[model samples]
Target: MHIISGHHHISMLSKDAKLNNHFYQQVLGLRRVKKTVNQDDPSMYHLFFGDMSGNAGTELTFFEMPNIGSTVRGSNAITQIGLLVPSYESLVYWKERFERLAVKHGEITTYAGRDALHFEDQEGLRMVLQNNNGEKVPDTWQAWTGSDVDPRHLILGMGTIEITVRHLNRLANTLTELFGYVEAYHSDNEAIYQSVDGQSFGEILIKQDLGPREKPGKGSIHHLAIRAKNEEELRYWEEAVKERGFYTSGIVDRFYFKSLYFRESNGILFEIATDGPGFTTDSSIDELGKDLSLPPFLEGRRSEIEKNLLPID
Candidate 1:
């Protein structure tokens, strides 16, 4: 029952890889760390970007499909993807930037016991930025490099990716039973389940009566990842996840870490992934994503795969 840590990453489906990359890289300022294909759907690209090290909570991934099926949003679709920052005051700074940049935005306020701002990416993915008191992350500021980003004012963790769920009790029970989340707090509209570890990691809020599921459309979260300390813990999760009635994927080794996938009763895909052998596994800490690192099984196809992909760096 030791749920090793918090979120490892979250994946969303994108209709346009180039536009998606542009928004995330330029607007959000996150670094693209890996470019590959979906293991299950190799025809589509899997793009990963986050903090400098691709740390546990810093990961934001995408499955690039310009022609993906039409998406719809309703209950069960991830509502807002939140990123936690330690800087409460810099929120004003971000506000100015958002305004100056002229990206569509909305008001700021205290949503879940924290000061927060709500906005959307170009693709219309709802995003929330909140001040996490003082929790900080390790990624270097490559996005707004000269723009007064204080690590002390750094992102604490990923803010809860808001999700719409039906039969809250069933999903709630499953979360408590299978995953390790507990009822941390609740707002006037939703119950917030947070990691006992006090992070945006694993924090989820089930908004009451968000209503029935719809087809996922542009700007919807495809899945979210939970951390499994290592192979042993992941194996435990594989069994536990099965016993609870969610069928999980057989172990799949990503070059940086390993993973097992399953879905919560609520239909949101969940991945239990390892945190070790990070992006540094293939290249020096200085050279991640400079070149492709293939698993032995795919080594022979490296030149071919590299050739088919879009240029990142």
Candidate 2:
């Protein structure tokens, strides 16, 4: 079984939609590719922000669930997310640029067999820069050079997602059996299970700890997604997930991609998503984010949804 070819996406809960919008689109140079409400909960905005082309790996999405309580960081929830760069030179460029701009960053270090640097966003959302050699699914990321960036040379999927979990083995098995991942290697405190081909963009590492599970809230991970090459693969995944008796959701359209959600045995919320009907679904390259487009199911409530969200830009 293929454990999915690429890193489809990552979801985060944001307290301020507008602020998250500006930082990701204007500051980080990501394109506000789509605007819509959360499928599960229609009141909140589900925003997709990624590189110019909205490729699978480069996406950084947010759910404007501003009312969720503040987070108390711990294991069980994804602690920090990492974006893999092309090479060490790219990593160095980011480090220097963040420093020059006074972006708070931790000292650089080697991690999980790669060189890395860590930092947080304005809302204290943890993120990292990684330079690692691994197998990558084909992608298109238009670097935020403003004037132009050839999408062909864009970064691949997310480098890794660090989850501080109390349960290790169950999560490992879930990924392996259902998602096509295998035990690649391990650290003293964490086991690394990756797609057999070294699709290292998405990883589940456990920092063992004993405590109550983290409550989902602001600054917390909403979900981790795996890429299915197409709906046919995604259909196979839904069957595979249900066979394990997991709580899996029906396919939900997200304009750019389709998705199915389930809680893995390790208790982390995960998704299997298709890679088609991408960013150009509703609007042209120049018209993205100019309007909030929703699936047929949620378009009726757009006005009320607009009023509830605090203005960000």
Q: Mind giving the per-residue lDDT tens digits that candidate 1 earns over 1-313?
A: 5774667889888888778877776666666677667766555677777777677777888887777665667786567788876577857667777898887777778766678888887777888888776564434323223223444444445777677777567667777777778888765557878654465656877775556686886677888887888988888888898898888887888867899988787787888899877877666756654455566667777777767777644
- List runs of model 1 lying over 4 Å from the truth: 136-156, 186-189
Per-residue lDDT of 138 in model 2: 55
- Candidate 2 backbone overlaps, count: 6
Could you estimate the TM-score for every candidate? 0.89, 0.89
Give the residue spans of candidate 2 off by over 4 A: 132-137, 147-157
- Report model 1's TM-score to 2 decimal places: 0.89
- For model 1 the local lDDT of residue 311 reads 60
* Lowest-sum lDDT 10-residue window in model 2: 147-156
Q: lDDT of all predictions, in order shown?
A: 0.72, 0.73
lDDT of 2 by residue, 66-134 (tens): 767777777677778887776776666667767775777887788777888888776778888778554
